[model samples]
Target: MSQNTLFDKVWDLHKVADLPGGSSQLFIGLHLIHEVTSPQAFGALKDKNLNVKFPSRTIATVDHIVPTDNQSRPFKDTLAEQMIDTLEKNCKKHKIKFFNIGSGSQGIVHVVAPELGLTQPGMTIACGDSHTSTHGAFGSIAFGIGTSQVRDVLASQTLAMNKLKVRQIWCKNRLSEGVFAKDLVLHIINKLGVKAGVGYAYEFSGPAIDLLSMEERMTICNMSIEGGARCGYVNPDQITFKYIQERQFAPKNENWARAVEWWQSLASEKDAKYDDVVLIDASQVEPTVTWGITPGQSIGVSQKIPELKELSIDDQFIAGEAYEYMGLSPGQAIKNTPIDVCFIGSCTNGRISDLRVAAEIIQNHKVSPNVKAFVVPGSEKVAKAAIEEGLDKIFKEAGFQWREPGCSMCLAMNPDKLTGNQVSASSSNRNFKGRQGSPSGRTLLMSPAMVAAAAIEGKVSDVREFLKK
Candidate 1:
């Protein structure tokens, strides 16, 4: 058990009661819904004749199935259009705030909420999507719930769950030039093994994490679920408060000071105890990439793939599977692997900072004629901001398609997908089999800047080489 940590404080503050089986009934301060997962939950509410317990606390948006290229109404995909329609109808019936297409606020559920200042420190946030832990970057305790839990929250505004142990991941040293936050998280997941954080809430602390911007911190927490942590968070500080201060839904004026004071108080005490602790030196992290299907099967760009015999028995089984599925051999150099597509988007890496990094590389560089490349902003606001800064022009002129905001190729629920056996250099998280729509397609996860470098070379090239230019 952990004490005096942010996880403990937020959990204790929101605990409504302890149930018979040792599960605590925790009240959720915010509920976010999306088209793909909400339809079934809203339908469940209809079967029970229940209305949202707190409509104002819930927000709705459409993202997964929305097309990034052609977003015309009455979507060509009948099922996608139906899903969006159901969400719109349900939000209207329940009187919940819905950011529909062309609303200027419409985007991925995760991106929309945070930008609107709906994600604040010390609040318990829940979403039907696994990456809901992204909101935890603001010092909140956030969780990704199942569809059944979604119904539970809508009807009662609370969840029953066992508490998690806290693991303090202390990062030290400053990241070297050309290394991005995405690379840091990938390095963490690669080192700790995917399941190391099971049953634990990760407390990302230390000077290295503090140096990261709010969006960069979000990138770290966003993939916390991928590392098998129940959730992950960083203590709120000046960076967090500055990011939230002028946003659309942030507390304003007289209330802003009170909010800041309360948020600051939620930080862990200097002598806080944790169940476990792991220290990592940020200087050792390079531009990292996922070489195999799982995020755990990753290696630095300059490194060679692991030999099967060198791995532990438990890891050998998956290594063989990865070798066959990825069409890669043991001890092969990870760089120079040809890629057919390059993508820069998703809740994980589609923030404005991500775009700026890629744009810096795309200037005076052209995408390889053999490669297909595109950039999809995470939200309408991100898209608008990028356009204002002329990032859109940089991408378009560099032979990359500039797309509208949505969860594009990240999941491939929409038209942005990889064809059979095509290899992709993707900025989005996850490299699972068949994750990018095509059953045989291969995905290599990397930072947005790495993806840009790959797009230019038509192969996996070291982004540091481009940074030097």
Candidate 2:
């Protein structure tokens, strides 16, 4: 058990009561829903004839199955169209706010809410998507719920859960250029193992984390679920407040100052005790890429693949599976592995800052003829911001397609998918088998900048090489 940490504070604040079986009834302040997961939950509600308990606390959006390339009415995928329609109808029936397609706020649920200032510190947030932990960057407690849990929240605005032990991941030093928040998170996953945080909530703190922007913090916390943590968060600070202030849904004027004060108070006490702690030196972290199926099976871009004997027996088994699936031999360098497609978008890394960083690498360069590359903004706001800064043109001139906003290629529920056996340099999270639509497609997860460098070179080239140019 952790004491005096932000996780403890936030959890205790929102705890409605202690239930039987040692679980707590936790109140959720924000409920984010998307087309893919909400339809069934809404259907369950219809079956039970229960209206949304707190419609104003819930927000809806269409993202998962919407095509980034062509978002015209009546999506070509009949099922996708139906899901979107169902979400729209349900939102209307419940009178919940929905950020539908073409709405200026429409995008990935994770991406849309934060930019709108809907995710605030000390609140408990829940979404039906695995990456709902993305909202935890605001020093909030967020969890990804199953469909039944979605129904539960819609009916009662609360969830039953056991408390999580807290792990303080203290990062020191500063990241060098060409290395990024994505690379740092990959490094953490690789070192700690994917399941290390299984029964814990991760508190990412210290100099390295403090220096990161709110978006970077989001990227780190976004993948906490992949690391097997229930959630991850950073203590709210000036960076968090600055990012939230003036956003569409943020408190204004006197209330704004009071909100900041309360958020500041939620920070962990100096003498907080954690169940576990791990320290990482950011200076040692390099531009990283996932070489195998799981995010934990990653290595620095310039590093060689691990030999079976170099890994623990359990890791050896997983590595063997990876070697067979990825078709790469032991000791093969991750660098220079040829790639066919490059995708740069997702809730994980599709913010305006991510686009700017990728655009910086894509500028004055051309995508390799052998590679097909594209950029999808996380939200309509991000897309509009990039266009204002001319990042879209930079991408287009670099031989990359600039697509409309949605969760494009992240899960490949849409038209933007990898062809058979194509290896991808992706900025999005996850590299699971068949994750990018094609059963045989391979995905190599990397930072948006690294994806841009790979797109230019048509291989797993070192992004540092481009940064030095």
Candidate 3:
């Protein structure tokens, strides 16, 4: 068991009682709901004749099924429209705050909460979406819950769960030029193997992590679930505090001072003990891209895919499957692999900073004639910020579409989807088969800058080349 780490501290702080089966009843400080998952839970609540236990603690938004292109009344996708309508009616009936489309706050549930200052240190946050671990970037204990657990949170505001062991992943040095948080996290997942984190909560720390901005930290934590970790977090510091200081829902005046004081105390002690620890040199990580089905099946853009014998026994089967699905040879280099679509958005890398980085790399360049490229901001606020800074103009002039804020092609629940066997250079997370809405569509995950570079070249190109000049 880990002791005195942020995970331990936050878990203990939120533990309401010891359940009979060695699991603790943990109180969720924040609950976030979306259109796709909340409808079923709300229906369950109606069957049980229950109301949201703490309406103010929960927030609602429509994201998963909302089309990024046409968001007019009565969505083109009838089911999507019904989902959003149900969420709206449920939120109103329960007196919960709902950030509807065009509210300027509505977007991906994960992206909207943090920007609004609803995600803070030492809180236990739960969402009905897998990326809820994104809130952990603020030194909180957060994780995704099933629909049943969503109902549990709404009805009682707590969950029964056993504690997870803590693993401290100490990154030694700063990332090299052109290597963003996305690349670093992909590298970490590749090295650790996806299931290495099955029973653990990852504590991401060290000088390398400390140097990242809040948005970058969010990117790292956002994909912890992809690595099979229950959740991931960075210790709160001046960087975290600065990011939260003046947001819409953040504490004000003297409350701000007190909040910071408390948050500062939540970092792990210098001598804290962890159940496990791993160390890596972040400076060595390069622009990374997924070549296979899972997030862990990735290599540096300049490296060749590993041969089956070169992979561990546990990974060989998946490697073979990935090779067939991706239509690539084991010894082939990932570079120059043709791409059909270029998508740059999602809770993973859809923030204003992400757009700015992609735009910078795309300046004076145009999307390849063979590629379909677009950028979807994470939220209405993110979209507004990018437009204010003229990012939209840069993208449009570079032959990329600047779409409305929503989850977009990350999951392909909307109109933005890949057709046939099209290959995509995507900044969004996940490369699972059929994940982009085409049974045969292939997705290669990379950083936003890398996605931009690929969009320009119509292949998997090293982003560092663009950074050199």
Candidate 4:
């Protein structure tokens, strides 16, 4: 067990009681709900004839099922429409705040919360969505819960869970231009293996993490689940306070100063103890992309696909699977692997900063004649910010469609889905089979800017080649 680390401090501070099953009943300070996962939990409450015990602590938003392109009354997809309606009705019934479609606050739950100041430093946030760890970037403890656990939070505002060991992932050195936090995380995942964090919480610290903006930190922590970590977080600092200071839901004036002090206290002490530690050099990290099904199967932009026989026996089998599914030959460079679609949105990297970075790559460079590319902001606020900065026009002029805000092609619950066996260069998280709403659709995960670079070349091109030095 770790001592004096942020994870230890936050867990102990919010622990309600020790449960009988070798787990602690942890208090959740913020509960974020989306359309897809909340319906059944709401139904469970209805079955019990119960109401949300702490409505103020929970916030509702429609994301997973909402259409990014055509969000009109009654979504074309029957199931999606039903989910929206269920969330709306449930939020109203429980007197919980709901950010519905067309509501400026509505977007992906993870994206909406931080931008709106709802996710604050030193808070413990939970959501039913796997990427709820996204909120951990604010130096908070965030967890992803199952539907039943969702019901638990709604009823009692607490979750029972065994405490996790802490892993200190220290990254020093500075990243090169065009090497964003997405690439940094992918680099870490590839080195550490996806399951390395199965029983641990990751504390992302050191110079590299310290340099990232709050949005970048969110992008890194957002996919901690993909790395098999229960949660991932950065210690609060000036950047954290600056991002939260003027947000809609954050503390103000004296409360603001008090909050910052408390947030500072949550950081691991200089001599903090940890169960494990891993060190990474950011300068050595490259612009990375997922070559196979898992986030751990990533490689550098300049690297070639590994031959099955060259890998460990277990990974050799995975390589074989990827070779068959991705239709790529071993030893072939991932560069120039053709793509048919380019999707740029998800809880992981769909914020305005991501858009701005991708837009720079998309500027003056047109999408390939055969490639279909589009940009979807993670939240209405992000969308508004992009538009204000004229990124929408830049994308449109570069032969990309600028869509409305929602989860978009990240999960493809909406109309923005990949067709048939067509492959994609996506900035979103998850490249699992059928994850993009097409049974045969293939996805290659990369940074938003890398997706932009590929969109222009119609292939897995190196973004560093296109970026200004």
lDDT of 1 by residue, 219-266 (tens): 999999889996999999999999999999999999999999999999
TM match of model 3 to true structure: 0.99
What do the candidate models score in CA lDDT, each in turn? Answer: 0.94, 0.94, 0.95, 0.89
Whole-structure CA lDDT of model 1? 0.94
**Sort by lDDT, top down from the best:** 3, 1, 2, 4
Residue 380 lDDT in candidate 3: 96
lDDT of 2 by residue, 306-338 (tens): 999888887887888889888989999999999
- Over 4 Å off in model 4, which ranges? none
Model 2: pairs clashing at backbone N, Cα or C within 3 Å: none
lDDT of 3 by residue, 178-253 (tens): 9999999999999999999998999999999999999999999999999999799999999999999899999999
Candidate 2 stretches with Cα past 4 Å from truth are: none
Q: Give the alpha carbon lDDT tens digit for every residue of 1-469 in model 4.
A: 7999988899899999988888899999999998888888988988998778899999999888777778898888898888888888888888899888778888889999999899987788999988999999999999798999999899999988989899999999989887989999988988888888898889999999999999899999998888899799999899998998888899987898888888889999999999999999999988898888787888899998888777777677777887788777888888888899999989898999899889988888899999999988898889888999999999999999998888888888788899898999999989888788888888999999999999999999888888653
Question: What are the clash counts of all predictions, listed in order?
Answer: 0, 0, 0, 0
Clashing pairs in 1: none
- What TM-score does candidate 2 reach? 0.99
Least accurate 10 contiguous residues by lDDT in model 2: 312-321
